[model samples]
Target: MKGSQLGEENGRRSYESLRRTAQALETRADIARAALRLFRTRGWAGTTVRDVAREAGVSVPTVYSTYGNKQGLARALADAADLTAGVPRQLAELEAAAADPPRQLAAMAGYDRRLFERAGDVLRLLREAGRIEPELAAVYDDGRVRADETRARVFSSWPDGTLRPGLDLRAATDVYAALCTVDVYTTLTAERGWSPGRVERWWSDALARELLDR
Candidate 1:
């Protein structure tokens, strides 16, 4: 009887441990998705811990206990997005292109056209959703900082067709970064009422005629 009781207790403990771990994972996942949706849609001013909790179907205190506050949630979103391999994914695509400059440029153009298309649209949509959510105010900006780092890598090439050529990558990166600002694009589109197709056309043409073409 004693042996059987001990075995049963051990099994119960094991099940509890596994359950706790599963719950933690699910909670973290929910927090991440909620942050993404909330931050992107509303900005920090519009989103609140309550909003995130509502979106995740958790509770206000749950988000607070998990992340400490809105800024913590923003950092969490940044770390989570970094884990998604987006920056590395682009680098891999660039590496796989042929050695020829023009061919490589063509490949990169195609790659980035697809990339920017989604990024632009998602950010724009996020602007709408985040407007009412206070917890997401800094989240989009934080993500942009990560993207700026990637853009800097893209501009390290010399005009002479050498890829990632310069000793100082930031110089090239800043110029390209300035041109690719989301705010500028948003102002052009929302304030000026430009269509996405037209903006994309300009993006493609700008890269082709100005930067990569040289």
Candidate 2:
């Protein structure tokens, strides 16, 4: 009977701890969303921790504790962008398409399209914020480097003789990364008024033509 009571007590403690943890995470998410909105409207340099706190309906200290500073918030926003872009699922699908290079390239284009369509504003925010904040700049650069590495892995997974005769993995990754940058996507979708579907189709056809053997 004593052991049963003790186990029940422990379970209650665990449940309480988990509830607190979940609440903290939800608060952080709310703060991050508020920060993104402020950053988008007011500009990164123009927004402040107090502003985010007010926007999130939390204390300024809460904002600081959750994100440390504006740069930290920017990092969180980058993470949010990744989540919104469906990167993990897309990567899994990309890996599964290794046997078919055309299909893989098309998948890559699809990921790019979804990324820009869903998270372009967040990415643009990061890029703009990175210009003035050295730490945020590092974060932005790190994201780009990681993306390049992912592209390299995808290219490396291609079957033998799948690439154009002269195009090696490194070269192929360079081209792919360059062509799929947020800047290019912005140019096509924002500046040139091309639809996401149009961009996806163009990228799919373009990448296949550039990298594959006839």
Model 2 stretches astray by more than 4 angstroms: 1-29, 53-66
The candidate scoring highest on TM-score is 2
Weakest ten-residue segment in model 2 by summed lDDT? 75-84
Could you report the Cα RMSD, in angstroms, for every candidate shown? Answer: 8.1, 3.8
lDDT tens digits by residue: candidate 1, 1-214: 6999999999999999999998986797788678767767886568787888899999888888888787677655654454343545556766774344444444444434444444554555444545765445556665667666655545543345553334245554454556555566677677899865666566555644544534
- Estimate candidate 2's RMSD in Å: 3.8
Candidate lDDT scores, in order, read 0.61, 0.84
Each prediction's TM-score against the native?
Answer: 0.52, 0.77
lDDT of 2 by residue, 83-137 (tens): 6677877878787876888888888788878888887888876777678778888
Top candidate on lDDT is 2
